[model samples]
Target: MKTLNTRLDNAIKKLYTAFHNNTLHPECCKQCAVGNILDNSDSWKHFSDEHGSTKLNYVGRVNEAFGKRFNGYTPSELLQIEVTFLKACGYQLPIHYKNTKPDTPTDKDVLFNGLQAVIEFLCKLDNNLNVMDYTKIFDKIKCDFIEKSPVK
Candidate 1:
């Protein structure tokens, strides 16, 4: 049986390859929670210049953001797994904000908070050494994970 880590690794590679090959739509990525955070944050360029990929930087950022570690999982490995899991569960990028209101937080802020919540939940599960499928967990929490605003 393939280990969860192995599955995640393969998934990450596949997505990254698709993206680089132009098979994955750039807009799709921009909408994804992970992609949105990486693209908008300073970490994108910093990590890209250092690791050659923003995806790897995300893993490290999770560690810094949460102050926790997953056993037997490097930052890169964890990020690949998380991204793969998120994509498999059909999470799309957040709606872009117009930033019309300077005082109020933008859509990106809300989305980033939501993504952080999801990551924190995942990390807690990982820290507990739970090996269940990520999709199941996401299904249980997705409604709350991604907040929605009423359409005008």
Candidate 2:
């Protein structure tokens, strides 16, 4: 069994590669955040009927009931992570073209923001700090976790 840190690290690496390679897509199950975390598998999609919905379907409920952990995340957690990613990417839930979506789905900045959101959510699941949050490094005081950059 991999530790939470190890799993999260692996997920980040996978997402990094996908983002740089232009393989990450909000509509593609195999290239999405949860999909990449699960080794590019689309199996996690069965957890919900809608792409950005956190509501579990029958498959999800059964798996959750069995205490199944897909790549160290439960079905509910997977949905949450996907929702976080999609929402950060500027999609209105469930992902329909008629709804809302990024002007360019493959745009680097958009994808980076989505990835960042997912990473934060993943860390939160384990009650851990976001690995990508560098603000902590400039913490003049422990209470100043949200301090602005010293450069400005």
Candidate 3:
């Protein structure tokens, strides 16, 4: 069994490459968050007819019933991650062309936002801390331990 940390690391690396290569796209099954996590496979699209729908389709339901986990994420988790990514990137749910989207879908900022959201969700899935969260670094406090030369 692959650990969730390993899966999360691999997903983050794949997403980083896709984002830097300008290949990540909300409309592209093979370049979206779930696709990248699944090694750029579009098979995840079979989970649902709508891009951001959390409701699993027949295929997805069967997969879930079989305890299918792609890259350590369940069928429903995949949908939620994609929806979170799309929403963070400023796209409306279901990803209709008529729906709202970032002014430039390929913009670094937009993709970064999407990636960040996905990473956070992935961490949440495993009950792990968000690796991208730097706030904890700032929370670190230095404590000085005093040595006692003698005890009375």
Best-fitting candidate, scored by lDDT: 2
Per residue, candidate 1 scores C-alpha lDDT tens digits across 1-152 of 12355433333344344444434322244333334334322332222223223254554675646655333344554445334434333334221243122232223443334344444444454453323346767876877656664556
Candidate 1 weakest lDDT stretch, 10 residues: 93-102
Please write out the lDDT profile of model 3 over residues 28-134, one tens digit for every residue.
88889888888889998998988889999999999999999999889999899899999999998888879888888878888999999998888888878888887
Clashes in model 1: which pairs? 31-93, 32-93
Ranking of all candidate structures by their lDDT, best first: 2, 3, 1
Alpha-carbon runs more than 4 Å astray in model 1: 1-54, 58-69, 93-152
- In model 3, the worst 10-residue window by lDDT is 141-150
The digit string of per-residue lDDT tens for model 2 on 51-97 reads 88999999999999999998888999999999999999989988866
Error of 3 at 151 (Å): 28
Whole-model lDDT per candidate: 0.39, 0.86, 0.85
lDDT minimum window of 10 residues, candidate 2 = 143-152
TM-score-superior candidate, 1 or 3: 3
